[model samples]
Target: MGKPAPRSFAPSPFRVYNPPMSDANPLTRRESEILDLLAEGLSNDEIAYQLGISPNTVKVHVRNIFEKMEVQSRTEATMEALRRGWIRVPGIEAPQVEASAEPLSWPPLESGWRSWQLLVLLAVFVGVSLFVFWPYRSISVKVAGAPAFTTDSGSAVGVVTPRQDAPRWSQRAAMPTARSRAGGAQIDGRLYVVGEIATGDTAALEMYDPNLDVWQRLPERPVAARGVGAAAVDGKLYAAGGCAGESAITNVDRYNPGAQMWSSVAPLPEARCGLALVALDGRLYALGGWDGGDVTDTLFIFNPEQDRWEEGRRLPEPRAFLGGVSFLGQIYALGGHDGVKQRSEVWVYDPADDAWTPAPSLPESRSGVAAAAEGVSIYAIGGGQGEQPPLHERFDTLTRTWSTIDSPRTGPWRHAVAVVIGPNLYVVGGWGGDYLANNEAYQASHLLFLPLGAQGLQ
Candidate 1:
């Protein structure tokens, strides 16, 4: 038999006194404990571990502490805690200041030397101002452009030789066929887009020549697929693992810009579509893909030397249509549709230890984002819930902050990808309202705008 239920009782309600101009019962006992930990410089995760609580719970408590304390951040909360006598240092001393405290005073100096001292101080101030405010201009680099190409809801193609001082956009040559969900990469000196599945013809490999303002139809892809992922290694282009007909395919194909030929490499171990490919060092990493049934976080690593695929660590969440880029020899995966809704998680993979770390998350939730990483900054451009405004965000590895860039004339582009060469980025075809033939190039300082010199399109 089960134990009998206990009876509940009502107690008298008592008012908890608080300081003037403060909330009654300033903070709860748990919040006070959290504030004490904050004063000790404990992070949310660290506090969670010490208190044997979930990190999410710790986060909630910390947030509550800030509210009751009328503080913005941990530092502010610690300062307030000290003021309220909620926390104290063991050895160090802190002097409290009143709201209406007077400023410090200095004794008067002798009148004789005061004027001379004032003159000397004025001269020093002028010299310092001159040194700090010297006027000079930065030389802007020249970016050569041909005709511009744009997708639907975007501008028409033209030349975009923008001033390095300010961002500018120009149209470029459009694709012969308007399609979306194509995979693109930079190999040699040209941009290649594989599998235009929107036309129901998933066998095309299209090449764009930025210097010549032209589009050339290369040989068709070996497999009929769309939303395939492509990567470049040693000037060679690779396309693999995409949606074919009713399901994802496992075929991997390699294209030689020098030989103008296509060859089949080892296929992927699993079938996946809407996946992303990133090349680091000499190896390629395939991350988070969709396989009709549900999204997956499976990661695959391919070794060119061995010509085979090896499994790697899985993602923290199941997602697809996300963006992946290799930067500083590390792989970063960001923003995807987790089958239910859009995700903003940013997961980083370090090949050295083969472990994953959480960097800063994306500013907003999105999917079908195209990504490109050069040096320390990674760019996530286009892609949203459906078609909205053109959104571009840059993540700086050094500062770990995300900054928004000027939007493209094109409004709401999805199923597109970006490739870096030198300081320029070519964002190719995607579905906006219809199959888009638009291809636009972004030119900014220190951007990966490497030209396809000897590897120029034939």
Candidate 2:
């Protein structure tokens, strides 16, 4: 017993680490799953889609994983996991050294080379180098918000990078009737456009099928109005207040795609036009707009069950021609015009709290902008003054930050209607210069990672 008490407790220079069990691990089961996906370089939205959860939920898990591992970024967490032998990445093999009794050997070169032979070898090396670098020297990519690229020849030239995750825009079938300031809604994988300018045919309703890449005329609304607010709730499309001719009107209409018909619903309490409408938690929200004389901060909630419009909390400021959408479970109001000038303000309204809180502002003032939500990102496209490049920006709900994306149109694309169907964003006709018949389709940016497992092997 005395000899056992005198035993040494010194550390071992050569030690091995064994990963802990699930119960002893810092992360939970769900967190571990998220960490594995993060190692694959999947974005929050992509991870949420794969897990069949909301992006907000994915974000929460990511934050928890960071806290548990005491790591700041995904790369750090992944490296830490590798160091602890907690996870294994596919297709990464260690170099193998075969055991051998003989000494290492190298190929023997000629004792001496002639000057002509050396010159020939040098010329071959230069040829191979130029051949390898020719393509890269001839190609360049102009990233969004990057400085202008100019060659010494003073000519503009670029090459398209073969990147799957890069944001790109493509042309779609042009609208039959070119118009601006129209109301748009999407239902059952189809986009619906209603009410163009009052000067022309205001009650023009059309439906676009992304699968077919075609547009079909639908039954017109009962009231001929323009600058209306439209949304779809519970599979039914609701079109609200807009201008008929010279003034705003309180006309609410509901369209059923299954029946291909339109029916009148309870109109708004007051007349307004150029408003922003969105559906949240089974109800319709009509945000700020012009009420004939001036811009208003009105927030009207429409109850389909009761068929009534209830006044909710007003906005922080009065604005018209704004962009609004129901992201996560809250209502977001983007930039709009307030009587005299365009605004860069952004506000979020939580239904549970019944209050409006200001979020991050846009990069520049915009009006008549179109906003749509896909996964964890909100796209604000087509607005702002001047003949500058089209202002196409994306807002990350998880990070609460905004970033610019590429746009097809070089000039302004205001008063356009945008809808997200599948992975493509369909932007219908708008007033780019005169009435534009442009049907620009934009593919949202995805974060492409190094393919893992079998894909990596392929």
Candidate 3:
């Protein structure tokens, strides 16, 4: 073979383009230069001119400097650099300063022009931070094309939004009375509230008409009770199992809104106070409560059609002063006291299978909280820590995780009750030591949670 033909020079497929290396560390060169310029009190424009670069480029470099230094602002950057041996005062002769240089000046850059630029950049940063870190707040919501009645601090507050200089709704109506430990149910567009007080139990039953913004007292409960468990089924409000005369009672009553009358129903198998009741499918399920003196583990199911009560699977652990809500056809029981200790354990009951399963645990142990389901999520609102600590917690049923919420309006009470109408959740009736009548409502500030494969609206 006449001397194998010289192979033509071919670039290797695996070779990557390699740029020419500069004398200094390219990753940090721009940052170092920017810091030096900043220490010399040179304006970005002046620094740009001295470095023969665009002011925008200088800005990018300064930003990199700030980030690499893990600082918030130019002042913070300077302080950090001085502390980290990255920069120094002129007279100090530090390792970073190789030659004599003027002392660094305040604000770093020229007064009028550079100050404006810095201010503009700062304003931009602040705006971005606000948009990123600020807590989202729900503005307005409508259900069935009508504004729902929302309660705040035991008062009826309406949503007010200006439309063409006209006030949409800006009036506050008085609540019947401050109620804590109260249970509420909505029937035929009317909201009914029952029982909640530590002492001098209230048989007072009140109904609210959202369209008229008026509250009227309905027929009083047949038996005076507090911490009562309640549910609405077939247009009738069922009140059952509450504390009466310093003892838990199994007295159950049903109220007919159309007739404005009350009738006794089959009492729950167990007398419980601070129990949670939810209407699911056509039956009512009662879970978690104090029976006489201690928390009970029994779960009771009431069939309104049959006028009977049946025992369902018991809770994994006995708990009382708890909060429960029906979400995605399942009953979720959140934090509550287990008689001897506070618990963060959350349990879910599936009626379809008649079984109880463990779900996510709460971030903190608490009891006497209130819960309500809106859309696909259940929110556990303010409650006392165990039989003590006054704090508030919230949980997303879809995500099965607990998060602390900013609840400046959380009352000192522990056994509060909650109900959801539209996008608002109202917490009512609780007791710290004394009976708390404070009624507070919280608006879901984030998007309504929709669980994966959820079939119903959340």
Candidate 4:
């Protein structure tokens, strides 16, 4: 390799987003674990003891963490981690002190004191000490069921019944190619996956048939890119704005299944990747993304009839790798990263008013998530790392609340795409330490299974 050309601007210190940690977070799994311990006021030796590692190794990890996070001390690192939603502190209430009739004071013992008087004095002293300290006993009482470290999505406890409408996931046929940052679109009961971080085939394209549980390759994408945003409209799949190598690109390519050809459309006003593309009312809306150097708040809309991209209202907060979906004639942009931290804020865009409004925030903060709407609910899947793994959250539009849903994978699941077909929500390829070929299907409807004896009786 040759020396690379110099950049026009200085890169951000938090830009080392790659392998093992996904694209948003910068720390490794072990480093993140150590950081969590540091935030809990643990010394290096204590952290080493907890992780079953040498104290010197823990010190080295802490040094690397400091360098990566650009912090000089543990306090700064803890604050940065907390700001990024990388670690959560449980509700640790402080012990309250009560007022006494007299100030805590003691008079010097008189030299003429007798032996009986001295014994009485010692007994009184012991009683006073117990009375003063008794109220603080509850301070050491740990929060029951609270894990040493966990995400905002409260830790799971004793057995609980699953909701009838809760989404349940099951593994299906894996993709032929294992890759991360792939984009997906659902058309005609088939899901089309395009672009990802593969060895030499970033533009790899394949389609999955749910009923048959089979995958077949289609014509590959002409533009080699990952972190692309895709949506199906009018029987055609549109993939737009993703990182082509190290730089973000504005290329908008459309694929016609009937013709089996790819063609270019009007490019975006600016180059960006990790944005969200969703079709609402026959038009494609490109939401927030990262524009090479910084997270973008820009929104662009593409009209097929005009074959041009138009700039729309700026996002309430700039973000990338967010989950966007059209539900009940409105666009909902879910949790995403804003360069520094993962966001839990949910925003709803009204096409009629051309304005964005706040909605109920997600139960947990994440980015690179897959969002799909089924019936009256929207599912936000995966996109977590650090002290936490990717998880699922469901938004009940009718109730205007968010709740946790069951997920198949308990590890990092960022950069995946989701699409709903009938009663099932399918989450496609994403990164989990390494590139994944997982094709997991989540059933949104209630299902019942009969016992073997009951089946024989029937």
The top-ranked prediction according to TM-score is 4
Q: Estimate, for each residue in 1-458, the C-alpha lDDT of model 4 and write its tens digit.
A: 33223212112112111233432677888898787655543444345545767656987898899889888776577657655556543331223346578866545556577778989977975566345432222112222332211111112211111112333668787676655567888999999999763232267788999989888878878898877889999999999988765578999999999998999999988998888999998999999888877888988999999998888888999988899999889999999888888888999999888899999998888887889887678889888654357778888888898888876765566767789876678987765644456678887744234346332110
Displacement of residue 142 (Cα, Å) in model 2 is 40
**lDDT, candidate 3, 295-379, per-residue tens:** 7898999999899999999999988767788887889888877877778888999999999999888777877677777765667
The sequence of per-residue lDDT tens digits that candidate 2 reaches over residues 192-300 is 8887631243677888888887778788899877678999999989999887655778999999888989999999999988899999989999999888778899999
lDDT of 1 by residue, 1-458 (tens): 33222212122111122334442447777776666655443344335545656656976887777777777766566556655655543332335556656775544667355867889977975565334321110001111120011112122211111212226555677665555667888876688888643324377888888888787878877887766888888888899887765567788999988788889999989888878999999999999887756688999999988999999989989888889998877889988888788888999999998899998988888887899875567889877754456578888788899998875554667678688765567787765644556667776444233365432110
lDDT, residue 121, model 1 = 72
- Cα RMSD (Å) between model 1 and the true structure? 24.9
Instruction: Please give the CA lDDT of all the candidate structures.
Output: 0.68, 0.71, 0.63, 0.71
The residue pairs in collision within model 2 are none
Residue pairs that clash (backbone atoms under 3 angstroms), model 3: 179-429, 180-429, 180-430, 181-429, 181-430, 375-458, 376-458
lDDT of 4 at 366: 86
How large is the C-alpha RMSD of every model relative to the true structure? 24.9, 24.1, 25.4, 19.2
Question: Model 1 lDDT vs. the true structure?
Answer: 0.68
Q: Write the number of the candidate with greater lDDT, choosing between 1 and 3.
A: 1
Poorest 10 consecutive residues by lDDT, candidate 3: 143-152
Ranked by TM-score, the better of candidates 2 and 4 is 4
Q: Which stretches of candidate 4 lie over 4 Å from their true place?
A: 1-167, 447-458
Pairs of residues clashing in candidate 4: none
